[model samples]
Target: DVKVTQSSRYLVKRTGEKVFLECVQDMDHENMFWYRQDPGLGLRLIYFSYDVKMKEKGDIPEGYSVSREKKERFSLILESASTNQTSMYLCASSLLGLWATEQYFGPGTRLTVT
Candidate 1:
């Protein structure tokens, strides 16, 4: 069975601290995405990668970045954490092309920046 996992289910960080959220997929997917979910804003994309070492900015990429050095691993980095950055971080993976519609998601990490 395919699985996507997040490094943490919940995280707490102080403002101005550097934060790293990790996600891994065992499905050998060709695409990975990072999204932040808030109450009213819904799911806002932060970053996405179509291939290793290649990434693209998404809707809300100001305080975030991503790395996909290896096919199975994708990492989301918060350059400097802030209270406004607190949200539920979701990681998803999908096959490239037409199969991209079927995405597998991790449990998600709820991060609180104080």
Candidate 2:
């Protein structure tokens, strides 16, 4: 079974603090993605990596960045936490070149910035 794990299930931080959210996939997938879920806006892509050491900025990458140093690991970094940035962060992985393949998701991390 494809398993995706997140470093934390919940996080709380004060404004301006740096936050790191880590994700790892057991499957040897080539595409990993980071997304933030908001009430009205729904799930918005934050960043994604198609290959190790290759990343692409998503819709809301202004306050966030990502790293994919290893094939199974992907990390999301919030440079400066803010109230508006507080949301449920999700990580997903899928096999490369297989558009129809299901993407496995990790348990989302709910972050609250005070």
Off by over 4 Å in 2: none
Residue 109 displacement (Å), model 1: 0.3
Write model 2 residue lDDT over 4-25, tens digit each, in one string: 9999999999999999999999
Q: Provide the RMSD of all predictions against the true structure, rounded to 1 decimal.
A: 0.8, 1.0
The Cα local distance difference test for each model comes to 0.94, 0.94
lDDT, residue 24, model 2: 98
Highest TM-score against the true fold, candidate: 1
Work out the TM-score per prediction.
0.97, 0.96
Q: Cα deviation of 3 in candidate 1 (Å)?
A: 0.5
